[model samples]
Target: MKILYKKGIAAVCRIAALYFMAFLIGACPVAAEEEQKTPGIHTWADLQEAINESGPGELITLTGNLTALSSDSGLMIPAGKHLTLDLNGYVLDRNLDSWGEFGSVIQVNAGAVLTVRDSSVSGGTITGGYHNNGGGILNRGTLILESGRITGNTVLHTGGGISNDGTAILLGGSITGNEALLNGGGVCNKPKGHMTICADVVSGNQAPEYDDVFNQGTLTLQEAEPEEFHFEDMTVVRSYMEELAILPFLVMLAILLYVVWIDSYLSRERKRIMLWIVLLVLSLILQNYTEYRMSMQVG
Candidate 1:
């Protein structure tokens, strides 16, 4: 057990720490430019300069724990041909619409792939907080979130955790406490994008669990099916037909009794009363619907 720990985990942390130092020394300048990248710039302008000068496929490593409290972010990885913002357990900038101001912690374009490892992305809410569509990661191309945590990110739409406009393969990690205005409170796959949720835990998310498929790709759910079935537990959240027999009818009955008793004395407003009655009756008819549901009283 000890041997595996050192080889798999301990070694990775050590390498990250070592490389982080090297990253701050301007050792990796993308080779395409004369400008050298530093570890701790302590300002948003310097961080922006590093991003502007960064080249495709360049590795910007954090040597030390650089905090971007001011306007400047710890690192600004914008949309380019291809690049990777290697975070060695360092914190990114914390603010509003940071992606718009400084761009995402790292943005990927179409057909591009952004890979993140052993890191934490906080400061964003479920609705456009830390990330946009591809919330924690706004990807028009592709994204690989491996062995990390994307929490405190919020989106007004799908993928409160991650909105994948393209293909997204979830190799490892946990995506919780994210909110989506629409589907996939945890993750949203739009367009031709695909998401592989394997060997991970997706719980404690807000918003409706809609089709993880935002893109027309196949929505593959690779989890164990529960024995006790429920309407909400399934794909559907509401049952109109069930409400007709139970809740809707009961509610309609109460409304009719109230209107007839109170408005009976006001004969001059007969037309108005009739209008309300017709509207309520129409609502009852339209509200009725049926679906294959299991009894909640089952053992």
Candidate 2:
């Protein structure tokens, strides 16, 4: 009886061990897949492939400049997907007249959300079609530009740089040197579309009617405050502000590292570090407050 019981216990232990191993093996692939699923885009084909595979809220970064070889339809955002394309200081050139069809350099389909930043869209020409609009970008969905350039685009009808039939928000960028044969050389907001330009420059665009912008729908322009940096001017102030914006975060990180390193040291050193941090933070706060007050008084 004892021999039989020992055999049964050994068999049970082996089965349990097998089950545990299987469970671990099954779990490893999932974690590994997530870690390995980094998407990179260097060419137009790679960008298209990544866009097709990505779902909503996925961010795709451009690894290099991509110039369209053929006039095939530009990159299309899948419907219902909110994707962010980080241009990473790259350029998307449509290589105008490569194809005999009408297409924008970047098309945001209906019900899709696309945010483009830190990139440039140029050398796109849209013509000879029913929808000859938005030579640089045709947005039927929601489009947002944080900082980029839309220039040197041509359209036969309207929106030499951008055409919107949905919603577009320009936070900071420049739309210049685009030409439209008819109207809205910089941007065209259709009847169903809405555009909000907050601190963007729309200038030097050529159109028969509205040289800079044409709005048939809702258009709101929020000019920057006098003290704020005007991105269009590209002045010394803008450059200074851009450079200074990262200093506060860097200082905070340094302070954090100092605190961590001093945790094992004497109480006096800890107190001194704490005092320095407090003083630095307080100075920053006071400086910001003073600037705000001065701006208000000037206004």
Candidate 3:
């Protein structure tokens, strides 16, 4: 009975150790195999289909120009998903129709995130909107635009280029040649909305009031500075140390010490002591190698 109890306790400890190690070192779960596949959008139908198939954090790329064939709202991003639409130098045009009850080119719903990059939105005409806004794009969720163009869009009331009722980040883009009947010819930041422009151009827009941009909410304009790195700076060394994640290493060391204690208490076998020594050496080697790689990346 005594021998059996000792064996059971040893087994439990071994299982616990293995579980803890796995919890610390295991990789994050990957997306589904189907979701891993990136599909290209060419036509309006293809773009809609791709959006439907996308999951959160998925990327969809546009390969060619897409013209809206119907008078419906063009390309809605589903709620609760963070989707990135890479235009890849493509154009999305509304075909000069007075369409879209809401947004003409793209509509981002509440609790969703949409990132548009390297594209152009043109010829969008939004009439009779819910709030008479967003001719080119309507964003109720988070919207990010990078290296794109918004031009030749018209709205009946406000926000000829974009109507942001949520958060919008414009990074290195151009908003030009858009017209709004009332306010915000280039972009409208609503009362509850926030717009941040970092190194973007807002020019050649027309509106009855606030021709370039209308901000009823929080609007931040920041100039981007070119980053310069100097190898001789001691701050680089401090940053590298922070990136090394020393807390995790300390926790690992504590766990290893506990493992050693357990082994010492259970058995005094030369084989088990040798095994623990080998594991300790391996752990140190791995930790040092990881730290070296991180330092190299920082440098």
TM-score for predicted model 3 compared with the true structure: 0.59
Q: Between 1 and 2, whose lDDT is larger?
A: 2
Return the candidate ranking by lDDT, descending.
2, 3, 1
Lowest-sum lDDT 10-residue window in model 1: 290-299
lDDT of 3 by residue, 132-233 (tens): 578777889988776567777888877888889999877656778888988999899999999987754577889999998899999988676212211132
- How displaced is residue 45 in candidate 1, in Å? 5.1
Between candidates 1 and 2, which one is better according to TM-score?
A: 2
Q: TM-score for candidate 2, please give it.
A: 0.60
- What clash count does candidate 1 reach? 24
Q: Candidate 2 vs candidate 3: which has greater TM-score?
A: 2
Ordered list by TM-score, greatest first? 2, 3, 1
- Poorest 10 consecutive residues by lDDT, candidate 3: 225-234
Give the TM-scores of the predictions, in the order they appear: 0.48, 0.60, 0.59
56, model 1: CA deviation in Å?
4.2
Could you give candidate 1's per-residue lDDT for residues 1-299 as a string of tens digits?
Answer: 87676457644643453354333323211222222223444444555565567565544444334434445432334455344444545444344443444323444567565655543453211123454454555666766655456665556567766676666666555677766667777777776777655554355777765533343564555453221211121101222433334554445445544544454233656536555654554444333311112211010
The whole-model lDDT of each prediction reads 0.49, 0.68, 0.67
